[model samples]
Target: MRLFLCEKPSQARDIAKALGVRGKGEGCLTGAGVTVTWCIGHLLETAPPDAYDPRYKQWRLEHLPIVPEQWRMQVKPKTASQFKAVKRLLGQASEVVIATDADREGEMIARELLDHCRYRGPIQRLWLSALDDASIQKALAALRPGASTFSLYHCALGRSRADWLIGMNLSRLFTLLGQRSGYQGVLPVGRVQTPTLRLVVDRDRSIEAFQPVAWWGIDVKLEAARQVFIAQWQAPKAACDEEGRCLQQPIAEAAKAKMASAPSAQVTDVRTERMKETAPLPFDLGTLQQLCSRKFGLGAQETLDIAQALYETYKAITYPRSDCGYLPMSQHAEAPAVLAGLKRADPALVPLFDHINPGRRSRAWNDAKVSAHHGIIPTTVAPNLDKLPPRHRQVYTLIRARYLAQFLLEHSYDRTRATFECAGETLLATGKQVIEPGWKRALPEALAAQPGREPAQPLPPLARRDQCPVRDVQLKNNWTQPPKPFTEGDLISAMKNVARLVEDPKLKQKLKETTGIGTEATRAGIIQGLLDRGYLTKAGKALAATPAGCSLVDAVPRAITDPGTTAIWEQALDMVQSGEMPLEEFLARQSAWMSKLVERCKGLNVTIEGQAKAPAWKKKRKPAGARRAPAGKGRKRTAPAE
Candidate 1:
């Protein structure tokens, strides 16, 4: 019998329905000599440090770098029963089909199990982008040989082992070091988590060290035919900062006084240009998470969870773990069906139906720009809007709006910039008049506001040399503000575009080529892990590093905490995925680097000054005059001589 293996039960059910597999078994469905079974994520996981040797369990400096000669994986106890069911089916089958998520991690999940179970059969891969019946049927006609994706497994394995080496060894090394300093807390670290934590820690440091600089500005109100508009005084180049902020208070004050005393102002120049704004590309997981965090106050992980439900549960949208916001050219052909489903999904979309052109093509459709998966979009299957929870409906609406935007015309406007001379001071005013709302009309005005923009006020028409009365002039004082603390949305955006933050020119370009610090699927989890470990805390919507997080970043080596290091690893992993670098070679280099790190940290003499106090649950007050207990006999040995 031919067997189908899937990543989750929901995925299996969708595939089974498409293939007409109606008979239900213990952990699978069966019909017409075909069997479908599923894994609850991964049936097998890499063995922990203690699995190699019991002595490794005791945290000691000597056993810092634990590298196994031969890596091993064992069945996860929680999902052992499902593993048995799959193994039995594998034993009886002559052919097996891999029907899991289309990504590196999914490849590893299936390939690792087949290797462990010793399944020696012809294997085929079903690369489905969506769990909808039509998508499944389409994918069924084009199954790739399992060998075609075998390299992805190696790529993923290399990443997993490298993360393990760093996390298991470095985490132990730092925890032991913290214990020696009279702080009894586990200092957990990882390849991605460490660098991610450092980002917040460094930002906090910058904010703390920031000294606000005072600046001044003057605004002049000019009136023409009963219409009033404000014009900002432009300081001379020699008296202004690089950003054109008037830093010389005397010049600003003089300009304010001169403008106030002036009887009239002459319009020096008025330039108007028509501009067009293309709609934003559709949602990739990172972009979607960032938008949800900003608009709905949802955390990164929370956004991913909601998007995942829309994909797997309701079949309302396509895959949510996509990295590219560009759609494949081939997918453009299905826009009519998806558009029809969207109209049926919500009545609020009735007005937009007249504007959407089924054949219209936007810049978003490009085969070359598409990555592992295309952008997250609506499926041809329409979901019942009334049945969806509020959060789900809100997120679905945002995703649908972006897709609808592709069929509409570009937003067009006329931008007008006016320059005036008043009392020997040069003043500037700008305004925009919309010629066509176009794609912007598909979204609410609040949602369509550009990032970091305030509402613009429309201006009255003006001539190049027309004169106007000077109504009012006011001097305003402002201070340069420090960088704001990250919200989950801000953090997601930073991770996605981390190249902007790197100081080194070469490394910055490399990060840009390789995308960013973490994969779209894993970044949310990394941020969540930091919060669960108390390395980060939430204050309203802003994210802050706890004292422990700051202390750990201070104690760790710069090389490990640098975002550049993670970017380098990502480049190497990409090479592995493309077969440019062998899997064994990558692991060997990682093992050597980890060994040297452990050795270097062992001899280092450092103290964690101002360590964060233990959490209240772990804090206890002893009787007065009672001495604190020593950590252990090994504490003195672990500490270096001052």
Candidate 2:
């Protein structure tokens, strides 16, 4: 018998259905000598500090660094029964195939379960980009030996261990300090969460320190062919000319002299060009969250929850947490069928599908750009729209529309710019007129509803040297604005390896080579942790880090606070996976770093007031079954409390 282990129950069901398994039993489905079983989230979690030593159960400054000699895995209490059942099934099977999601975390989920269950058998890996039956079938037919995923396991293990080392140690350390300071809850901190909080805090500080500066600009209005044209005097030129001339002073002198001079303004130059706006790349988790937050006013967590529900419950969309924004080359053949289904389900989207060429060329569709899994998109199966909730219906529609839009003809527009001279000063104006709406027709509402505020309108078209009448002219006052606080949308964008935005070019190039601060699958959770710990708070869409969060960052060592640290580690991990670097070397470096951190924190002072005190001395208790009755009390037998 062969056993197929999937990451979740929904996935197991899909695999079983594809394999023609119709019978379901305890924790598994069986048919044709193949048994399919699933794990819920995590079957085994890293053992707690108490598991290493009973004394470590209570939070105490004296027990600051709880480093285990060797990390142990314990079955999660809620999933122990399922774990045991899967373990037994794996032992009986002749071969096992891992049918988890094709991503790093998914790889970890399967590998850890196998390691914890002590399963020894021929293992095969089923890797696919989508959940559709066709993709699954192809993956199954082309299964490779599990040894191919060994580096994935190493990367996963390294990630898990690094997170564990940082999270467990820092959470406990901070919790003890909080308790000592009379705070009631754990001061949660983690490798990813802390940096995310710092980002918010830093943004808030920038906003707070900003002082707006007032400046004035000259606006010239010109009338041409019964239409009014507007242009701004290039502020720097208006302030001073090539001969150190001040045009503003000259204008003021003209008013003082009462010399009504109708400045003859002419269009000095005109430039026109056709520009194409290609469809946006498909939705990765981060990009999807950003769009929903910026466009639909949805929170990051809310967007993720809705996307996950659509993917897992409705089965209308592909995997939601993927980072790749391109489809696999093989999926190109099914584009038409997927579009046909979308049109059938949402007839409103028909017009957008008319120009779709499955072979459309765009940087967004390159096969070489993908990693782990392809972008989130609609499956080939016709969606039962009625089965999904209203919000999920909206999310699914967005996903489908985006996928269809990708194959459609690119949006085309005519961009025009006009240069004008007034009062011996040059003014500039520009406009973009849509020549072909193309895919943009699908989401007109999304385009119309500009949430925050309306920006100034574009200038009207004009020919070179054409004379026009100025209806009105007014000087406008403007203020230089400070950097805005990080909206959840902005933070999501910043977190996607934006080291290029930093001033240092070397750092930017290094970060580009490594995957960003956190993987797409884990970034949202890391953000949520910051909120739960009171390290950050949401004011509207903007994130503001709390004083405690700022202090925590100040307290931590420089190496840990820097995002480049994670980037460097990611580069090494990638090398390990590519067979260019040894996993042992990475582990050794991590061990050495961990030791240094432990030694540094050992002598650090943390003060908490009016909280539960740690016990100074430990007492040994008898074995569970060998408890004795108190001597002074009645000889009556006492039972253990339930």
Candidate 3:
């Protein structure tokens, strides 16, 4: 019989339904000579240090670095039954189909089981993005050869081993060193999580050490014909700061007074130009998380959860873990079906439909830019809006809007800039008059405005070299503000754009090409892990690193906390994916690097001055009313107290 292995029960049912499998069996669904089994996630996990040698069970300085000579995989006890079911099917099947999440992690999930079970049968791969029936049926007909994606498994395996080496060896070496310095906490570390923690720590330090600068600004109200608009006093270069804020208070005060006394000013130049803005590309996971945090005040993990539900539970959107914001050109043919479904499911979208042109393609549809998965967009079928929970509806609305925006015209506006000579000091006024709402009409009002600034006001018509009255002059004092504390959304953006923080030119270029730091699928979890471990504290919508977190950043090697180093690893993993590097070579280098780090760090003293203490292991207390008999007094045959 042919067997199909899937990532989750929901996924198995979807694929099985398309394959005409209706019979339910032990831990699987079966019919038409095809058997489908699933893994809850990964049924197997990497074995711990103690698994190799009993002596390694106790944490000691002597056992600083534990690099496995021969790595082992153990079945997760919670999912052992499913493992058995899969193993049993593997033995009986003539051919196998691997259907899981279509990513590096997903490939690892399926291949690891195959290796452990010694499955030597012919294999195929099912690459799926959306859980909708149409997408599943389409994927079923074009199954890829197992060899096409075999390298992805090796890449994931190399990452897993490298991460393990860093986590086990470095964490042990540092925690032992910290204990001698009178600190009581296990200093756990990982390649991604530690670097992520450093981002928060560095931001917190910058905010505390900030020094505000005082400056001055002037706003003059100008009147033309019957219309009144605001104009700013232009400061001279010698008396102004780099950002054009006037540093010399006397210069600003004099300009304000002179403008106040002048009744009329000559308009030296008037320029009007039309501006066009294209529709925003649909979301990848990072951008989605960032916007949700900024607009809805949702946490990174919370946004990810809602996006996941929309993809899997409601089938309202395509895959949410995608890293690219470009859609595949082939999928453009389905736009009409998707748009029609949106109109049927939501009445509110009806008015917007009149503006959508299904034939008009946006730049978002590009073949070369598409990654492993395309952008998160609406699927061909839209679920009832009323049936979705409030948060789900909010996120779905955003996703649907971006897809709808693709077929609309560019947002067009007329920008007018007028320069004037008032009381011998230069003054400038700028205004915007919208020519067309265009794609912006698709966005909800909450997403319509720029996040940090006020929208531009329209200006009255003006002519070059015309005289205009100076209505009033207001001099304002402004201070340079400190950097705002990171919101989860802001932090997510930081992780995705980490190249901006890197100073090395070569490293910066590498980060930009590789898309910096954690993968879209794992970034939310990285943030949540920091919170759960007490490494970060959240206040309102902002995130701050705790003392323990800050100490960890200060204690670790700089390269370990450097995001560029992580990008280098990502590049190596990509090389493996392209078959340019061997998996054994990657692991061998990682092992050697691990040994060197442990040797260097083991002898150094680590100081941890943090408020949150890592709890020391405590002996279990005796159960109430079940205490042992007084020392050696009743050793013979006394009944235990109950």
lDDT of 2 at 173: 64
C-alpha RMSD of candidate 1: 5.7
Q: lDDT (CA) for every model shown?
A: 0.83, 0.69, 0.84
Looking at model 1, report the run of 10 residues with the lowest lDDT sum: 633-642
Q: Give the TM-score of each candidate.
A: 0.94, 0.87, 0.95
Candidate 3 global lDDT: 0.84
lDDT of 2 by residue, 374-409 (tens): 899898775777877777777777777678677767
Those runs of model 2 whose alpha carbons end farther than 4 Å from true positions after fitting are 61-64, 177-184, 237-264, 359-361, 384-387, 448-461, 501-507, 602-642
Better of 1 and 3 by lDDT: 3
Clashing pairs in 3: none
**Count of clashes, each model:** 0, 4, 0
Better of 1 and 3 by TM-score: 3
Cα distance off (Å), candidate 1, residue 105:
0.2
lDDT (10s digit) by residue, model 3, range 1-642: 999999889889988988989999999999978999999887887776778987776678787678888989898898899999999999999998999999988898999999999999999999999999999998998999999999999988888778877877677677777879887656767777788889899899999999998899888888887898898989999998789888899989988888899998789999999999999999999999999998889998899889988988887788899999999998999999999999999998889888889998899999999989999999977989888999998999999989899989999999999999999999889999999999999999989999788899788889887888888889999999988999999998888899988888888888888778877877887777677657889999999999888988899998889888887787788888889999888888878887888888877877887744322211244321121111101101011100
| Regions of candidate 3 where Cα sits further than 4 Å from its true position | 611-642
